[model samples]
Target chain A: MVDSVTTINSDGSRYFLYPADARGRFSLARRLSAYGLIVVYLLLPWIPVGGHPAVFIDIAERRFHFLGYTLAAQDTWLLFFGVSGLGFALFFLTALFGRLWCGWACPQTVFLDHVFRRIERWLEGDAVARRALQLAPMGPSKFARRAVKHLLYFFASLLITHLFLAYFVSLPELWLFMRAAPGEHWAAFLFVFIAAGLLYFNFAWFREQLCIVICPYGRLQSALTDDHTLVIGYDARRGEPRGRAGTPAAGACIACNRCVQVCPTGIDIRHGLQLECIGCAACIDACDEVMTKIHRPLGLVRYDSLAGLTGGVTRWVRPRTILYGGLLLLGIIVATFAFSSVQPANFLIYRMSGAAYFVGAEEVRDQFMVRIVNKRPTPATFTVSLEGLPAGMRQTGFLAPVTLAAQEELVSPLILLIDRKYYHGAFKFTVKVADAARTFSLARSVEFMGPDANLLTEDDHEKHRHR
Target chain B: MNSQPQPPHGPEAEPALRPHSYDGIREYDQRLPNWWLNTLYGAIVFWIAYWFVYMIAGLVPSDGAQVDAAMARIEATKMASSIDVTNDDKFWEMSTNPVFVEAGKQTYNSLCFPCHLASLRGKSENPTAIGPDLTDTAWIHGGTPKEMYVTIKNGVIAKGMPAWDPVIGQKKASEVLAYILSYHKKGGTITLQAP
Candidate 1:
């Protein structure tokens, strides 16, 4: 019955699928796209941008470089926009074209269908032969084929995981680590092996089960998509009645079961849109190839909205789409602004670990610690200056432009002293630091703390009288 | 497309629906996949092994003991790197060393210059400066190198000189002391002054 899962036997044992290969336009297009994605993945760490890998996430240095721009650990708050932007974009796309990412761009599908499945097909022949081989006893020929196939799977997984590690350590450092003994970099070594093992297990035996049971996106289709959303469906209106080729009053469907045979998830598409479908368009291609041979029009099973499949017009502009699109657009705008506003340096002003303000015989003073951090990969000189100080106030420390090495930080005391004559109680002032090239500047406002102005003048009068 | 249903596989009949219904919804009583069940069994086996090794058998050291050992190693390294603050001749030697003086100068300019002035002259260089002159042999607290170390390490609170030992630690405090001593001779004329 269609009520139960096709890949689960009645005895509760696993039921592996041997999906027949489908060849048509959609299959060809998806193959090309998957290959393009795989090439992009493999080349990102090899390509250098601005003296670093294109997408290096240098966790050891706590600097994440995307394209040419770099972000220090302090700029980690920008990750909020990145994560949310991806979420909203997915929501919008899912509401518009259902499960497009799953069938096309998802790493699981790309690796499993394009990479591992091709290896399996080349070694074991077509679907029927593969099923027969599985049913047969463990002979020498069968054992050798299984061993070679699994060995190849393990190697492919290891290669992928090694490239994945290059994203974090960069290609040059990864090469160094690869050449070194595993004991020297035990953590990274363990990580790569463990990740590769997991990938091998996932791609080798746990194939369609991951999409049907593990992935939450497939389950969210009902909530993310509606009637008008594009989905691969059977045209029940045009292909309902079952009949042979020459039967009168028969619909276009000739009961060839080509759609069911080519299903990767093993669900009958003619039974209508179901959760098991990943929307890969395999059934559409299979049905088209079948209908063309029998002198019937194509699209017996095709990509169409549920409304269109039921002989109704599909509405593209729905309330769900507008909301999702608006949210995605807002996230993009905010993410752009946040990324552009990231400064190449950071500074902070804090009270030195002492009395907030010092009072001496001839002056009133405020002491602060100004900490400056250069986030660039090269050395830069920063000039520290004070602004909005009262007249007759003298400044000390960081008088000259201090040069800091790459990613270096410095903490120095900034002392501001006002002569007793010009000391007019406590006031607010700014401590500003800027690069030598005047590329950017950071300022912090600090309140000069002291006793009342009247008290100082009264003390002065008392001193004069004593003299 | 046929009205007739296909026969169920294996020895089992059709999957039986649960007797109870909640708002017209009854779930089927289907057995879980063997592979999924194997994962549960594997987790149980791992838990037993881990508990036996780490908790009951105690083959591995406790986390607390590991932390204590790490802390002791750090303490040993700290003690090895620390210098004797009470040695007067060592202070004089560090004062004469150019590397020590240069490092001390950097620390001095960053911190001590605010009160003592960049020249270490304090009130002598500018009448408005906050601290006493370090260049003079007259000492308000003490005149010897050890006494100067003590004064710098534990400042005179009544005079507004902060205790710097906690802020800069023993090493940088000693370095700043060396920078101050760089301006003076080892046996220069010394006089005691009342605060």
Candidate 2:
């Protein structure tokens, strides 16, 4: 309402932006970033780290593998902290540099500006030829070119889909899926098929509408950015009341509109910051190229913070940035400590379902059930024994080791038999369990009722015989 | 009657296709991206090929059939490695063999000894043993092998005898029954504590 700039109209007609090709210092950096990001996206799923995919999510088993470390379903808290750390990092970056990610690093912009543009320029020629071809009459040459271009887009979408699917399924399993019959894996097939179609639409048509209308990350800009946030800005004060070059005592700007033509989202930078700008530095490149021809100094459109534009110093350190940084560091420390101390198997012991305790001729017996879960991804053998067996207590009734597979639990019956003489009130002992190799051990304490020890003596055997 | 003239595409160099003005702004009729149109056409082509192989020619099996086949393969691997004690007739035949009795004695000592005692007399002082005396000529249920096998498998619930089939599996359960039957036929006088 303030500047009379609207992107989507009620009439359903939109002005298309055709940014001319630009080569500059920033352009080189943006291009390199685009290549690096695309490579990471494509190759991350294929590489193996510690016998696992570098990053994989096995949804069926609720396991996540990140850089060789595996986190089971119970360890979901670690994943939550990891996500929060990423969020804090984003906040910190936004506070220092306004919308830098949206311009140079965002996938939407990178694909459109780097990949799709190169494809477009290679086939349809520059901006002028592209516009002419659109208005030109239908012909065989035009149809052939259109067909080839579309074919390339379809195949490109399929490649991207394959790379995307690698993050969820393991490599060998994915290979098996690829070799399997289509109907056998119809669910996976349909997912990739539909995803390819969507990617094609996004890269080819949706373009800036994805960034301008949908991405809520941009909406956070207003709240996150302060006066010190560096953004691509045009110095309107010195360049206004514009005129053609060489007019006596005229303002520096010639009203060329080259900056507008070079913008990915077609907005004149001279109108100040707008939501559609994206801060790509394309206008800066275009303006500088023009300034060189006109024998004037460059930097008409440049990276300047709000304070700098208003003749004030740009402050780099602020309270908001410090808070986000501190939180991110704290999340990493706490998550690492918790992950290291997690138990491999959870042990629980309780009295058997039937009787509490029973006295035999020479011994007292209490039935119990030891429940154990093997948390590893492989089978483990466990031997259970009673620790602190005061004087004469023995483990009886199936004194053998048990083996359980991944995530499997056992509720085997156990009976603790202690000599009647050793029976006393409130005796404490621990149920100790270790793997066959004694690699690890777990202990839990349980209590049993007994006759008073003081009453016991050489006459205890006589009392046992009477019972 | 006056016919309206068509609007002109604003100075062809710019992005505008028509000269119609809205808030003093111009809009061009930009052709849809060639890649987008091609992708739609490609999808149509792909769907046709998929329909031919998966629907018409029937190259892929139905989901249910595929799953059933995979399940059978897994079950077969597990079945081949263990004794098929599920067949009660075959298990009864095997129970009469000398090898089964030998194995059965080991199972009885480990599992049945606590209640029946090494003496097989089923005698205990405090709380009294729940297991019936195995040497008695009068069987609690029946003296027949089938009756004893069923007793071991199903257990006498009211007498606090938990079913052994689930805990030790069918093979071991059959063996334990064989061990008890051996003593019943011989009327062994073995004693643990002279009781």
Candidate 3:
């Protein structure tokens, strides 16, 4: 067992690993799931759901569409729920199953292990042959293999990044941008190329180093996990005092080191659970394969908790897991409620850029600018009305239902006047905006400013006395 | 599993620990990967070059200068699109055009209708309206196109008319004037009256 990072040499140089292939149930299941995830990633921009791509962001228009639901810029606060909900979900999963996301779902692990490594394995053969090719001096055959492998990696990266861009710009717009001159859409062009370059650099060479050295989730394992967390661990009780088969006083382990050979991060699983373990179960599969061949029971190295490996029962319902799960449930509920509450339009009522209120000869008036924004994809007619206003109050502008085009916004004056007989002190009233069909409504409480009622009455009495 | 040479301390030798211990926990001082070190060095070099170019050599324009240039460009565009407010004939011509009048009427109804009334007859139609009658031959602030334009652009502040030029730009202000002119004849009687 090495005390330091296994993938880094004592001299600080990179020790590249070529993990041997382990063909077993876990590996096969992982491969199928990875393929499913990749297909979903590629098809999201192609499948149209409710007139838009299934997951279009539409950054230029500031509308984010997921499935059929759309969120306008005014609904940006909902992003807090979306982000926090994902965070709590990750925390809950991590507390229950150690590094399951890193092994099965992380884009870095998925692309590197399945796509890039598969390409390398096909071109340069298995672990032993790949290592030999790496050590061999430059030759025509070796050069051709390396060049072709790198070319394929680059193209794969470009494909991934282009699809990523399509999520924001939509597929048709991305196609237009691609066909246009680079100078015409230089920002998007530069973004795509830069992203593709970074992805190629990551998947091609920076494999397990990302999980071991860079990923914050891997670093968070110690804090998020405990003895009850399911993890990939070796059974020291069964596999200790390793020796050849049929040797007396030796445990079941033949000291074959098959588990270490298949480890992508180059760590010995028999040394116990380490930070480098991504829970890929490669070591488990390798050990199981060897145990079966030797006519012994499988699972010398297997998925179990620290307690389970030590012959203790694993507690599945711990306090840590319960807290995380509860939080996650709360987040989901709140996010669902918040998303449903988002209205199809936004409105703001602000005092106009003059006096707060004007007192005329026979009336008291207030001027306001009502800005209405229609966030829906279709034109909507909205009816504006004053609620809880005193009698004899007059409202001008928005006398009829105003119709706004798709995603259009309009700012217009709204004037309210009261006859001297009905003049009252400054008061608060509600400005109600409802759809023409009265399906949904939004209201903002606005204060109508005016002079004191007694002051207006005093002026009237003074004028009357003088007359 | 290749037969690579082990470190000089032997395969079973443990890594040496650092001198300091915090709360019963000690750390191993391992070397950072050469690739990570190279990235750090690259960032330092980039920072030095950026500092020299932007701060010392002044090769790229400062952020303030860039903002100023952008603002200047926007001002130039606004000036180019603005109508000639001083031209009386242009205002009369625009009043005769239905396109200008329609756009102006929309703006007027949305903003000016409360005080002036939708019919543009202010107190004449409704005695308690805020503004004076616009359709009348008598003019409080001169009734000619240019005078009326001045009155609309820079408002009569004492009488509660807001300066429309800043609220709506010069173009929309002129459009509003065109809509008002559509109600009157060019050579009609004009009598200046006291407020």
Candidate 4:
């Protein structure tokens, strides 16, 4: 390698260091990436976040608790809007840049990069050794390595499958099922088996095909991205008219092909950006190594927009990006405010039967249904009362205060009877809920219907008084 | 129109075509197959037969079944209402009912004897019977008929009282409420004592 440092000018910045070289084999990186996919994909579900599974989609109770927020079926529309907003934002981000998520933030990419690579490196050795092992005939060395690697991979895949189950059915419940006898929880066992099988098949064999074909996000990325978005690109201007290092003046174009050797997807960046490229910066690392050896400037391959490379008119402000970003911020604010404004507990009131309005041997009376919910971890009692009604109106069934156990709901049927003379049309009443510590109130209005005023005569009143 | 030569494996191997029609609109012949038609016909025939037997012929279930279904609906509604912790329809009813209030006073004097004392006045030893001060409007649970029903049914297991749901039943939970609610306006008296 040359002693002098190389400098490449792109995006109005100077790079003093050269890119990395293809010291690691492409096959090794691929195998390693595969192994990483196994570990992360397996462990993701099992990883607990605040005593809860990282991911869960509980659709049965019409309650979905993702992370910590318990979303009721009523909140399904809110979730839908949030998801759509996220999708739009992602689309906008991708349109400006090609396959950025595919290489970086995507779970699939992150898993494959961090988990599989480490495992593969541990088992089959580095890129070159793995490639050599692949090429080797059926011998003891190959057999040992292959057996150990396959066993490790399968175990990792199994762990990943378990974690996936934990995400859907809470870890505690799943753990109980696992601890039970095999025949006892046949349904649970079946679920675990099938889910694990799917996960194992995915990471073990599906691999890159998942990113290229199965993932719709990658396909949609092409539609969202414009030529202006920053992407990993090869400076065909400098690196072309390709020839060896000691050849005639052919620019800085050293056709070493290290860039190709290091690429995980096996695509030539020099051919310009393609859908298959994950933009992993491996090519940058590789080409930098080549530049160092030849004592030339680096960054034959780098991240840049078309405008940036061409040195033409470039505007940083893109309408779609700005709009999507603004919307995302707005959604976040709304979600935050909604969660902050209301305590998790909720209350509902309904009128009961067997009475309408009055208290006598023969009188009209009304019955109501009142419900209290305690959302806290500890059991609590709520003092409930009514407002916006006349002073004579009273709730007669419950103790002065109603206590609810932790996460418990109390339903009370009450009787409300106003004197026939006093009872009338629609009335609005507010139900106030209070613990010893704090109070929350909700209001509801209901119409009171009864027989006409003529239904009760002076004689009827006299009979009721005698009774 | 002239016949176009087919490109040998280019990006566009198939040429896009426009249909000819009398109007501006043209349509594609996409129709359900015979098997699908047969399945649909079978479904319709089955539905008609089922409807004739169940509705027209009066050959379905009895009135008892209808009653059972109604009961089931009531039970389901109760369960749904139970899941909600903030509803107090029963309490509201009791609060408004003088008779229930009278019944509640009776229950309070009987059940609340040892701890709450005879006058509905709280005792230092029992100290409100391991419960809230019924006389005070500041209730720990609530002051509604429904709330009273629930508290009586499911006693504070965390506190001293056992959950009465298994023992007393929901109807009696209301009776217990009546007894306790009687003490709401009356406390600090040595009115009744247990034998």
lDDT on C-alpha atoms for all candidate structures: 0.88, 0.72, 0.89, 0.58
Model 3, A1-467: lDDT tens digits are 45778778767888888789987899998999999999999999999988899999999999998997889988989999989998999999999998899889999878888999999999999988998999999999999999999999999999999999999999999999999999999999999999999999988888888888898888899999999999999889998889899999999999887887888888888888899999888888888888989999988899899999999999999999999999999999999899889999999999877677888887788888899999887899999998989888998778889999988998887888888888778888999999998989999999988898998999999999999
Alpha carbon RMSD to native, model 4: 14.4
Per-residue CA lDDT of model 3 for B32-97, tens digit only, reads 889999999999999999999999999999999999999999999989988778888899999999
- Candidate with better lDDT, 1 vs 3: 3
Best candidate per TM-score, number?
Answer: 3
Query: Which parts of model 4 are misplaced by more than 4 Å?
Result: A1-78, A95-98, A125-132, A168-172, A353-363, A425-428, A457-467, B1-195
C-alpha TM-score for every candidate: 0.92, 0.70, 0.94, 0.62
Better of 1 and 4 by lDDT: 1
Ranking by DockQ: 3, 1, 2, 4
Clashes of each: 0, 2, 0, 88
**lDDT winner:** 3
Better of 1 and 3 by TM-score: 3
Chain B alone, TM-score, model 1 = 0.84
Question: Candidate 4 residues A1-467, lDDT tens each?
Answer: 01111111112122211111244243246436655665655565566654445556655445556566565554565765568667766766675665666766666666555555456667776556665666789899789877876676677666666676676676777788789997898976887777666655555454554664457876665666666777888887787788887678686767666676555554567777675577777877677766877888877777787676666544556886777677777777876776555565667777533234433433344545667777654677677666676544544445477667766767765444455456544355566667766655545555544456555666467777999
The residue-level lDDT of candidate 2 at B195 comes to 19
RMSD of each: 3.3, 9.5, 2.5, 14.4
What TM-score, to 2 decimals, does candidate 4 have? 0.62
| lDDT score for residue B170 of model 2 | 65
Candidate with the larger lDDT of 2 and 4: 2
